[model samples]
Target chain A: MSILVDKDTKLVVAGLTGREGSFHGLNNRRYGTDLVAGVTPSKGGQDVEGVPVFDTVHAAVQEAGANTAMVFVPPPAAADAILEAADAGVELVICITEGIPAHDMLRVYTHLRRDERTRLVGPNCPGILSPGKANVGIIPAHFFSEGNVGLVSRSGTLTYQIGNELAQRGFGNSTIVGIGGDPVVGSSFIDVIAQFESDPETELIVMCGEIGGDEEERTADYIAESVSKPVVAYIAGFTAPPGKTMGHAGAIVSGSKGTAAAKAEALEAKGVRVGRNPTEVADAASEALA
Target chain B: MDLLEYQGKQLFARHGVPIPEGRPAATIEEAVIAADEVGYPVVIKAQVLIGGRGKAGGIKLANDREEAERHAKAIIGMDIHGFTVHQLYVEKASDIAEEYYAAVVFDRGAKQPMVMLSRMGGMEVEEIAEKDPTAIARLHVDPLVGFQAFHGRRLAFESGIAEDVIRPVGTMLERLYEAFVGEDAMLLEVNPLLVTGDREVVALDAKVTLDGNALYRHPETAELRNTGAEDPQERMARERGLTYVKLDGNVGILGNGAGLVMSTLDVVAQAGGRPANFLDAGGGSKAEEISNAVEVILANPKVTGVLFNIFGGITRCDEVANGLITAFGSLDISVPFVVRLDGTNDEEGRRLLADADLPNVHVEKTMLEAASRAVELAGEAPPEDADRPGPSAGADPDADPEQ
Candidate 1:
């Protein structure tokens, strides 16, 4: 019943021969993800972690019926990898690679819009994981367990930390998706939040956001009008001063509107509980649940 | 990543765009010579990355060589919004009949390349956008179609550009778009594209920002970056491969995770303290990384105190503690340091710090306590080095500790 990915979800690791791809693929298998096949151009016959390798996503999907793809390709080649997976009808494409140029992602995003049926998680993100059912990308498998809440964020490492914090408080997740840290990601907080809202299994949601962009404001507006389920949000970059760009390309507060105060005000106005500390996020969720 | 207007014009000139003849000068003497070469009635613009240079007294018109030298001298050493002006650009001024604006930048919400054109130019475009947003014509260009002739024409017409100048305007827009995409620019602005008395369109001003991440692909653009405009701490951070940006505050922060670092900043503020800078040493940081981070923080005279907030996961807490201990020996850090280490091997992390027996160092259990200590220490003056026990003055107590 998990959204985006589950036990029945067959997965293919794009760029599986690379160090990061191989490492995650091996871990994916170990974590009980249906690691069906691997894709690396010109390495068709090679096998990684006993999973068969193919030359392209199309061939890999054709042979193994893989519906989900976890991409580990570098920045320059990430756009092509996404399009290849989308063209092959892979339902969910999770890109774990960071620093894909914004222009390249804009092209991929345009293509994704026309496709309609395919959904993407990131071009510079840590992938999604449905505890017990599937564990894709790099989130530690033990940090999450099957629960009624959904978690989504623009940060990779933060998502992992938040999930662990929630689990420690005995509040598990239905699914956790890291939408990525790039400014021009394929999907956003609103897209993931919408999916979580629609999922019957997800009774509540935790959204971790950073400074920069109108994504937080846009999501708040969306949640105010459409969402019925309670949302607990923790926005980062509050201590970040105006005009200082942070680590994530997306995490910049250039103007007055993009400041942390502005974002927190917008979210609070939407009736979403906003927590200041990482440890307080679960507590906020608990209060929202009540 | 932000290029000064003069540097951007240099890039535009390379792309065949008609930019006013200009050269950047560091001194009034050089500026006088440049003005002489460009002819009289030149424009002396202070070379800065920030906007609103015109209103900030950064841009001035000089009717003669004497005026040019005077303006250059005044503008070069002036401080506009915390950024000191070190260079002045002397350029041939254009005769203007009409002003137009055009730019190509990534529109995050649209997830596409957005082309913004306006009939109103040479003013704060943001204010115009707020007051009359529709006055600014925005078009999302398909990456496949790109900045084609038709796209440019549509943008020009929508901007209410004159019919006679539409062709040239469209052509210029297309060229600018090409420059934007080709150069991996985050922003390309040609403000006040002047239609002269003779009906010739000329770029009066140029501003461009190249994406730093894409710098690896464009080495030439990378070379154009002026490190003088950046804060010393920011420059140091870039060299160390750490994502650090200096802000005005007293409490200096060092953390492993970006999220944790950000949260720590908020925590500092919420606890009624201001963080001096944001420094993320990255995950799995060793002793040297911590020491380097400490050195950068110490380099800033604004940073009155130091705070180390680490939530160990893949990054072991003991590793950070050892780094802090080692930093005591390497750097003559006179400022107070408040350390908070939690998660993996927490006890060992605390034990390592305790064994170091360093003065002006306090260990706290919670992030709040550590932040409070940092704020408290920042409020007080640093203890005298002669009076305090130096690293060499103490015995190596943890020299033969169990692994």
Candidate 2:
């Protein structure tokens, strides 16, 4: 079975009245996502695409039975939105908004850690999709189809590329999770890998990561210790020069620890198939599957 | 956005940080006037948005007005790290009994604003921290509580500042933190926060980086943006709603995808030519977007050739090919262009380009071949060295007079 989301997973669009929220919500519904509720303060009782609207996530969850929450709030209010959703007992929260001031996320991250029941995906992510089951964020739905391989990534566009490559190779995906490109995201690579490892339908997993953070190192350690599943990884920022920040806010390797070379070496040492090129990711996965 | 030391100090001075009186001068006359106002023993520093200016001969200590004027004249026209200086900051130099460093920056690990303090000042705190991290004191400030007196006092004590001076240092740190957070600053640094012989601390230098995205909140900060220091092509790209950065290379790249642009650069390098710049025209781009991208690529003097690697799914291949034609027609692009269009309407894309009848343009069947061709065109030697050095004979000064 796919992890985090499936066909029956009921979802609510928080801040759905906003531009990105409304656009993505409509796209999600068009892609057959079970978007049952919409949440927007003062715009309650209104409907977007026939979905019932509620003032707060709590009321929406109670009335519409929505367990998953997708947020498109702006940076300043993003942390509060996530915390409100968590307080309302949303089982899963995916934040698509980027550029939340760093200090704001730290408080939210600490709160999420203390609350063990809630699982959050991103504060600067594209969200996840279990192909043929549900699409949560902005990833093009047609590029993904139901299959045995699971994919997880910290990049939005790279996730799309890997999904497209897999679809072209005739291998569909069980789930594609965008853990987001923020340095302090809701979940880490190791956390998603743990979920993929336990999924029975996920025969092989592809992990897409960028430079910066010790998340890859942690994932390598976890893979070495307990993981037996065939894993293929493609790490970005290899050709990138040292001390330059990339497009992603989280993707900067200033200190000695977060270099692309170091991450690639760590993944390779753990027997995970490491692909250097984005186009070669599918080939590496194909070999891993073989 | 990187701010010059004088600009950063302006913000610091507004936030109540005790800074030496100074003014940025565009000419030696202004420098002399500023030096006269600040009194003798002034320091003349080149106003450039680069680090290590002192080592690059951009900073000089002047004992008098004439010395300050001479130093300003020398520094104003100097180039440091590719940035030419047009202005000099003349400030009252301070006597240093002790030097301490302080900075406020976002810590990714802690996911919060952090203040770093060190007794070892005037030097790069990074090196000092690497050698002995214990010598530096780090405090994570809660956004709600901010940098209170206790936080600053703790840092001051940890950094080994005297107990009596802790209150003043604490006040300074608190104000600096307020400025850092209030200004939406990415980095706020005070290098060589000099402690005078009388035990008074003053900021001798300031460096600040403002978040570009948050500039809308601070109009004053947005006004401080120096467009002259930026590449003309980059400014054009920004005006056209494109993200472009000029690099030292020859092969020009135009792609919709950031990942694709990066891969194109790597492929170009692998194909034996460096990339002139990274320009993302962005997805679902139209004819105008393509023309803008072409303009940016052709603007780079180093770019000898151009490559368009379009993978069309939502972005139709024929549309991109038509855009290329439109761009070529509008701009006088003399550089050779190599294109590889794949996906939707591929044959139609090829047919459209063929119909354009453009010279110096070649369509490739694969990305690899297109990259290779672009590299080859870029590797061609220049027609002539227009700015080459003049020929000089080895004649003795005694014999060469009047001859």
Candidate 3:
């Protein structure tokens, strides 16, 4: 019933013995996700949160048939983790680590393109969640309600905030995704939107974009020509001055391009209702679902 | 970080790339001393990060020591592109027989490291690329293949490099790539890569921008951070492990995520208020971090009001509330402050703030209502507790997940 993951999905936690990986692995387990195995180097016999551990993703996959991998490895080792998961033949890989150098991502992205079996979500993102069914990376599951609308965002807390707002509006979500706010990431808006478009359970799409790159503008181009469902969108950083990065490495206004005004204009031209704020965005989505 | 020309040349020289002998000086006396030591006919160049230094008279030829001193006096403390020049680079000038361009930059469209070369090179290279794109020969080197001898040969041949100088130019290209990879540079450009009378290929101008994300591994490169060019709040935030950006407004804004903070700025403006700054306490911010962010924003004299929009995910709303109370203990905050808490542990956070009952602190149930209240209180009108919930307020039973 979700765009990317659901009840059938079996998950493995990479770097499961590390502080972040183990802590969040237990959290996902508590939320009733199918977190069946863990991976850590040279810790093959150890168990975290009662889940069996292996030294390599391939071993975990061979034993548990895990199809998805949630990576919490540090920046230097994150690329290798992603490649190793892909090499192990996982269907989806989500990396939650931040500050991986862009060059490292570039090489990993190059290699991943040649391998057709896997789809990657983020190296600096909060991973995807199918509320009440599966929790992948760190999103608080209790804050959401199960329903038809699909949400994707480039931010962490903002994704939770909007999803919680929709739940508070008596609307439920099919899937909520954080695509990360880095310049180079595993997935893009168009990639996630295309999936949402095909999921029959997803009646509408809610996108949270910010000032940076032409990703949103490029997504607008894709929606104008192909998307049939009503999409409510919000773009952040209108008051942001040119040339200053507003926290995210990718969320910056370079020269005159990638301005919030420019992004809003692009989305509006595509017949999408662009909300001025979070509440306006939720109201727009609610109205469409009605 | 964009290294000034002197720093870039130093990096190039360290990497075995040919560059003119140069020394940086902060005063006219130092410039004259450097020129005397290096001999006459030196070039006095102002050290500034902005472009068009030559057009703005930041670069001048000194035929003698007197001219070097005079140029240094005029160039230092001179303003170009709003940057006040504080240092002068005095170097032994080169006699350029010909000029070409070479660079290694990450091309977004190609998704690879690209080596660019052109016969037409100089300050006008930007114009050349924009107008006649084909004049530049760009090669997107496969990371696996990397910059190779054949790739260097292709650049040399395609850019119309002279037959006698082709090998030297190719060598320079390889060295440039080495410098780019070795320094973890985002951009390495030698505009006007000069061929001298002695047939030596040298970098006439060096400009390198290091990847800030990769600086953790290169602590030596990290020391090259231009503290003089950094904003005080920006430098402080970087040291404190907080993401902060200073804006030209009066409303002090703080939030949990970058996206939420950015949206807060836009909404605050929509509600007839200007946000003074952008401060993201980050996911799961602790009490000390919350107080540190508060101190940072309160330090801005233009702030007439403060807005705290925390959507607790990894960040606990109760911790943010306690942090706010803790901040009041050590600081003097007279302006109106509004806090909106939602997501995990929100009600507990709200209760913590309400029980404390700090003066000039108000909590609204929704993000929009909170922003509206903050803007209202920032002006002459005081916020009323009667407007706790709006018609579309998310706290209604159907919306509340617990119900």
Candidate 4:
């Protein structure tokens, strides 16, 4: 059993006619996800690789029975696309678009909180993949194998790197969620860890975090209190100088706070084994499961 | 992007927030002229981005032309916190009757815009919070509902703001909120919000940090990126559209993603070598982007060794190999390079590098081995003629280090 998606999911791709949307939209469909509909304003009658297209999310929901939305709209219009999905009563929205302004995300976040029906994943993230059941967003589904471990991270390629390492060690994942590296994302580490804890298939959890905010330290407290599943954590940016963003907008060290050593120490104090590298992370996961 | 004090005041003035009248001067002559125009008893403040300028003797009060010139001569070109002061902000001094603090910053844990107010100012907010938690009144504003007058009034009353200035302070909060939203600022702080003898509130200092991602919407503010104040290597990376941060070490580091690059730095440090810089070529980086990243990393004169750690996802190792080849073709590389390529198309990438058999370039299988090898190489004696002029060699001719 996966946390966010499964065989019962009916998917709709927002901005489906665009370059990235069409590419990954078809990729997800080829992976056997129930790609039901597409949304491209003023192009309702058109279709993208056998999926029906609608001008609005409401039409896609009413006619095609789309229960979920994967947004690839450009950064400027991406926030409105998510709001439109929520307005149309889509249960879950996953935004793959990067570079949406933080101010816009704040408004979208506040709106989603009030709406309460829709759960948003990312505005700048590689989407979730529950292997053998569903594939979503940009995660290379081939790297993952269906098993008992659950993976969540704030990075894209780094997540894939760890997945490859774990797979090499004979540890497959139940579900992999990329909550994004933006300062204000839809979900946090604790939010996804809680899901993994309740899932029957997920016996172990691996969390990947980087420097920036106190999210990792806070997640350490949450894991100590609530998560009974064995958790292995990896944090990055130990040598990062203060007040410089490495690559991702949120991957930075501000003053003396948000250092990787501090994060690793915090997780270790909570009885979690913090990996020093991706290979170490997989080894730690293997030890926990063993 | 942190705005200098003068730039922050300019932005505040645009948003109708009261700020002391000031003008920025790049030369001592201009500073004295500005002081003359602003009248007597002007403050000559160094226009540097780093904090603690006051403690560094970068700020001085002048009563007349002779004093203004002397202060400007002392402040200009002064090195404060490793940043040379190329400009001075001359402003008329204020007669303060009271001091307060106010700021609007994103509360990351709560995922909301937090408005903070405190009657205790002229000190670090952290000190205030630690000394007395209740000294600062905090309120989170929902972007959907927006900040309103009641939010400010509540904070004022909670922080025990004087009754006579509560209404004015509340109005100031509204304007500050507008500035925060309109300018796309991540942090807009007015420390020591001074209440003058005339019972008027004016911002004595402005500390603003705008969202770098949102700068595309603010072209005018985007142009305020002080090129003269930036590290030459960092400025080059910015121009090349690469996310790079300059560090003080010898092992130049490059990788595909932020997390991976950061991990590389940590691994290098753990292996007993300091990283020269952080350069993330980004996911799915094309051959050209990799070439650019290599150039940027090598441009740092402090780099004695290089490490390329790529964990391919969308970024294929073969493409990275091609980029490395291209860099070798274009650049006369002197330092030793250690490359660790894994994941998608990694074998192919390794084969390409083996076929090239480039001089001084070694390929390792894991991040640990590569970092260890790079550190070992960095500890070696430099090859003859490694010493060369840096990109910023002649950029600042007048920056006297001993000033």
Candidate 5:
């Protein structure tokens, strides 16, 4: 009943020979994700541990039947790697690489929309994890406990913090998706929330958002009309000063718009309980479960 | 990376967009010389990266050398919205037949670049958006197919652009699009895109914001980063590659990730403490980076206390603890610190902190507890050596006879 990953998922590591790529790729494999192949261009014939390596994603698809891609390439080459995976007809592409130019993602986004073959997750995201079933990106597998609540967030360490809180409260997760903190991510809050709504294993959803864009406000509107499940949400950056980016590329308060208070009010109006802080968010989710 | 007006116009000129003759001057003499060279009836504009400059009296029309010098002298050292102007853009003023607006900006909701045109220009776009939304013609340019002339023509026709100048406006729109994409700009706007008395359409003003992330590709444009106008603390943090934003408060805050740091700021505020700055050491930060962050945070004189909210994912809590210990050894830390360590290697990190027994350091188990402690520490009686404003310090302004 998980949304994206499961036991049947065959994953390929796009930059598997690089420093960060090798580390996270091996980590995902250790977590029992079905990592079948690695792509490193020149050093394609080499293998990391026991996984096979191929120069092209096409070869990985042909030889290893890799249906999913997890990219850890450097920012400059990351978009091209995602495009290559999409062109090879991989069903899903998750990019863990951060700092990709917005223009690069803009072009990639346009192509992916028209191609309609690959579902990209992030150009600057923590990736996804269907707890106890499969792990895809950089999300730590140990914090999550298998349960019925689906969690989606725009941040990484913050997601782990909330996930830890839930686990300590004896609430496990069905899936935790980090949609990224970039302005032009592949998946939006609405996209993942829609998936959670249809997921039978997911009964209550937890959303983590921050100041920046109208994505969270729009998601609140969608939840009011569509979602049947209860959603508890938390938005960071309440005290953030306007016109300054708070680490995340998308986490900025522009003028009077996109404040955390505005976002919280928007969700609360839609029958979604908005938490004042992370602890309160977990508490609200716990109460909804009760 | 919001470019100054002169810089924006320079970029527009590079893309074949017609603009008024202008020169950027850093002094009154330079401005007068530029005004003389550009001919009489010039406009002297304060070169600051803020809005409402026109309303703030930062812009003035000069008919001759005397007027230009006076305007530049009044503007070059003037402050507008906390930003002190150090430069001026002197240019030949235009004779306007009609004013129109054209811009290319990123549409975050639509996930595409949007090109907009409004017949109503010379006024703020926000005002136009509120008064008459339908007066503007907007189109989302698909990056794959790219922006076409047809799109521009359609915008002109829909916005009721003057039929006589529609072709030129369309061409200008296409050129603006080219500049927007070519320069990796987040926004490229031409406010008061003028239709002159001679029927020539030219850009009277330029507002361009280049994407900071894309600067690596354009080194020349990256040089336009003006550090002089930035907050000193923010400039210091930027040099170290740390994500830091200065705020007008007392409690200095540091954390692991953007979200966590932002959350910490809110929690601290809720606990009745205002944050002095926002600093994220970033993921997987090592001991040295943490020590560097501590140095930067403590450097702010307004900070009475600090909070370290570390929720380790890839970042190890012990490394952060080691960083704090290292900072204590190297720096003179006067402010009290509240540390909250959780996740990977939390027990070891806590043990190390306890073993260090730093007098100013306090460890808490939860975020709320840490925030409360930090706020309480900040509200306590100030030390004798604290850099608090006193009668003696405040008397310096009184000593000035100019008042």
Candidate 6:
């Protein structure tokens, strides 16, 4: 069984009238995701890619019984969309939009934690895909193949690269979750790992992290204490110069606190095979299963 | 984007944080005039982003006009942490009776703004946080309610801040938080918040990092972007909305994702090649973007080869191939290119590249092989690559693209 979304999931597309929202909404639907509703305020009677649109998330929830909300609103309005979805009884919110102000996220997160109704995946992430079952955000649906291994990463392209490597090497995935590359993402590696650990189909886990905050280190600690599944890890940015942000807002080595070396050392301490590169990571995950 | 001390203070001053009166001067004459206006015993501080200005002799007390001119002359060309100073913050120096550390920085762990205060000030905050972790008081603020005076008071009380200075420090923190939130800053700091001999709290230094994402809302702050101190390649990349960092190597690395780009750098280094730069084409990049990236990378003469390690997810490889073909028609891309395309519809992309059959392009199946090929094409001398010291990533001494 997949951890996040599966065959029965009904999705709502937030900001469905926008460029990427409508584009990815169509792509996800083409991949067989149950995108039943769309939300674009003041366009309640419209349809995008044949999905029925509503003025508000609550109206979509009422009319289409949409449980999952995929947000593609701009940065300034993304937090409001997430809050609206959470308030309107959305079970899951996957925000594919990037560049949401950190301050906006701060308030949204505080609100999100207080409410137990919804789970938000990202403000700047590729979102999650449960192999052949569902494609919630922007991850290309066809590249991933259904299998026993579960993968999670803090990066978008790196996840796709490693996912492709795994698929090419005859190792398919049960679910690959992009927890996002923002400092204040909706889901953490620990949150996804907990879900993966309980899934019977997930026999092995691959965690791809990069130099940034202490999330990897914290995840490593959690793994050492609780996880029993065969886990392989790869921390990117070993060759990256310190203090210079390597593209991602979260992928920065601040004051030597978050370095790739420190992350590798932490993970290796937890009995996780740490790969220096993606190719090596694929080999390590393959060997872990063996 | 991290602001210079003077720029940071400007935002603070706008938010009503009491700071030393200062003006940024780019020339010796301006520095002398600023020093004269501020009166003698002024501080001529290099307006660079990095810290340790005092230790690097970038900060000097100018007792008179001639001294200020001399100090400005020495500092304007001085190199600190590889950043050559081009401007100086001429400010009326304060007579410090006591120094206290205060700042509101983004704490990633908390995922919120954190207030940090310490009686032990004038030292590097990073160093203090490492060496004497408990000496500093920390408070996490909820952005929903913003920073409360109670939070600041709690920090002051916990850190054993002097009783008389509590109100001033607390008020200063409230205003600092205002500046941070009002300006959409990721990191706003006032290290060594000095209490002058006249018994008044004043920010002696400021380090503000405005949220690059939110800069669109604050066009005025966005206008303060100091492209003058940036690498020409990096500046161009920033303007084009592409993330780029120039390194001291010959292999110009381009990739779709940041993590993958960083991984490409590592793999290239493993293959005995140093990455000349880090450039992410970003997700869903079309033909035009690919062409732009190629042109930008090729513009760096130090780059002997280009490596395009693309795992097409949202960014299709076929689009990149189309971009490369379009670029070759106009751009003088003399360097050999190693292209490794994989992921969604990769074979179609590969076929397109093979059909184009550009002489300088070599398509590889694996990242390792592609990196190896790029390494070989980047002038086969790893030892010399290590020996030749190049300009720092952010600071380019001679960064004129025309030059």
Pairwise lDDT winner, candidates 4 and 6: 4
- Relative to the true structure, candidate 3 has a C-alpha RMSD (angstroms) of 7.7
Task: List the DockQ of the predictions in order.
Answer: 0.33, 0.23, 0.42, 0.52, 0.54, 0.55
- Candidate 6, DockQ score (0 to 1): 0.55
Write one digit per residue (lDDT tens) for candidate 6, span B220-327.
Answer: 988888887898888888878888988777899999988899899989988988888999999989999999998788777788999999998888888988888898
Q: What's the fnat for candidate 1, on a 0 to 1 scale? A: 0.43
Query: lDDT tens string, model 3, A99-212?
Result: 888788778888887777898998788888898888899888888878998999999888877887788889888999989988778789999999999998899999999986
Lowest summed lDDT window (length 10), candidate 3 chain A = A249-258
In candidate 2, stretches whose alpha carbon ends up further than 4 angstroms from where it belongs are A18-20, A73-80, A242-244, A253-258, B130-133, B142-145, B148-150, B162-164, B311-319, B340-370, B380-403
The model with the greatest lDDT is 5
For model 6, the TM-score of its B chain against the native B chain is: 0.91
Pick the DockQ winner. 6
lDDT of 2 by residue, B1-403 (tens): 7898999999998999998889889888999999999898999999998778999999999998789878988998888978899878998888888888898986655556788788888888766666666778888887655778889988998988666677888888999998987887878989888888888988988989776656767899899987877779978887888867666667888865555565666677667777777776655678778887898888888788999887664456788888899988888888899998865577898999999878989999766688889899778633433432222212211111111
Residue A155, candidate 2: alpha-carbon lDDT: 72
- Lowest summed lDDT window (length 10), candidate 6 chain B: B394-403
lDDT of 1 by residue, B1-403 (tens): 8888888888888887788788889898999999999998899999887767788999899999889988998899898866899889998888889998888877676666788788888776776575666667778788766888888878887888888999888888888888888888877888888888888888898878777778778888789778888788889978988888776678899986676788888888777777888888876688788888888888889788899988775567888988888888987778889998876677999999999888799999877788877888788433333521111211211111111
Q: What ordering of candidates by DockQ runs from best to worst? A: 6, 5, 4, 3, 1, 2
Given the true complex, what DockQ would model 5 score? 0.54
Q: Positional deviation of B171 in candidate 2, in angstroms?
A: 3.2
- The CAPRI-style docking tier of model 2 reads incorrect
lDDT, ranked from best to worst: 5, 4, 6, 3, 1, 2
Single-chain TM-score of chain A, each candidate:
0.97, 0.97, 0.98, 0.98, 0.98, 0.98
* Candidate 5 off by > 4 Å: B380-403
User: What residue runs in model 1 are displaced by over 4 Å at the alpha carbon?
Assistant: B63-66, B130-134, B344-348, B354-360, B380-403
lDDT of 6 at B206: 92
User: What TM value does model 2 have?
Assistant: 0.88
